[model samples]
Target: MRFEGKVALVTAAAQGIGAAVARRLADEGASVVVTDLQEDKLGEVAAGIGARALPLRVDVTSRDDVDAAVAAAVERFGRLDVVVNNAGGCIVQSAPEDTTDDDWRAQLDLTLVGASRCIQAALPELVKNRGNVVTISSVNGLAAFGNIEYSAAKAGQIAMTVNYAARYGSLGVRFNVVAPGTIRTPNWDNQPDTLERLSKMYPLGRIGEPEDIAAAVAFLASDDAAWITGHTLPVEGGVLTGPTVLNPALSKKEYPGH
Candidate 1:
């Protein structure tokens, strides 16, 4: 029970990585507020996790919704100690020339803008409590992806994480980012072949699981990382550093032994 008696809020926690973070924190004795667009699924996930779980329906893009979710956590539990913003998705892959306004907006909403809302809504409480924030940024933020819009949004998110840390460090509110590579989730459940393909591509010989990312998020949000802040920790199984086709033009000697 690393987080015994602490309170945590996790966004997009109905399923996938968010769900895993919520469940793990609860198992460690933290009272967790789980938010998602799917309220029924949220309840089911919350129930499965036991007494420390409280689920709320949320669309992270909405500031009011984000505020309400954070407030509810304090109202139901005793205080706020940690927050993990894990609501983003890679819903944009089109090139800038081919991308529509909707494509840009949707990806930005989910990745960068949505995270901004949640962080803003959580700040006062976090500052008061001297709590921590773990934002689920992406490897795309570090390296450019073929998807222009998603990459831009994610890069913005990484910047936002740094911004939060910069402004709040004096207040003792820590902020960090966890950028996962290819985590195994329901996203691949529907396409088993796609999952297998991605797994084969990883240098670790397998894709990551929700728990893998959850472990990192929990560590960042916990007191174990008390001295850490304003960093992007990549849990990408070397994807960000390894020999991926993303930049195949580099010489082996230039990028070797990854």
Candidate 2:
């Protein structure tokens, strides 16, 4: 129970990685405030976690909603020790040349500024508790994975973490990022063939699970990483080493006879 008395607020906690992170924290004894726009799904997540969880409908793009959620978390949990900024996702669908100014704004607003709002809202409580933040970035931010707008927004998150870590270290707070490779989330549920093909690109022989990311968040949020900060831990199953698709024969597991 690393988080025995700690309280955590996780954004986008309706499902996938957010849900997993909330559950992981609750399992380790943290009172979790789960926020997402999906009210029904958020309720289910809170129910599963029982009395330790509080579900709230929060639209990260709205400052009012973000502020309200933070206030609600403190009111119910009495304190906030960790903020998991998992509220962002890729929303742009146009090609780079076709992407508009609105597309850029929308992507950055949710993925980048949205995180900032949460951190801002909880800064007071976090400072009082010597708390930390773990942002869910993406391997796309670290490398060229095709979605230009999304990748840029995700990269902004990494940059934000580094700066926040530097600015707040003296205040007893820390910030870090988890850049994950393609995970088995609902976002990819309709793209089974795409996921299967992408799995081969990973050196680990499979894509990541939400729990895999949750474990990293737990460590970064807990005292175990007391000396760690301003770092981007890529929990990407070695995909960053290089995608196996580039040279199939090089992967013995994927091409045994080669």
- Best candidate per TM-score, number? 2
- Residue pairs whose backbone atoms clash in candidate 2: none
The clash count for each model shown is 0, 0
Error of 1 at 10 (Å): 0.4
Best of the candidates, lDDT: 2
Q: What would the per-residue lDDT of candidate 1 be over residues 1-258, giving only the tens digit for each residue?
A: 889989999999998999999989988889899999988889989999887888899898888888888888889996898989888887866667888999988889888889888878888888889998998988888886456777788789889989889998999999999988888888777888888887665666778999999999989988899999999999987776656565444577887964
TM-score of each: 0.90, 0.95
TM-score of candidate 2 relative to the true fold? 0.95
| Candidate 1 collision pairs | none
49: Cα error in model 1, Å: 1.8
Candidate 2, residue 139: lDDT: 94
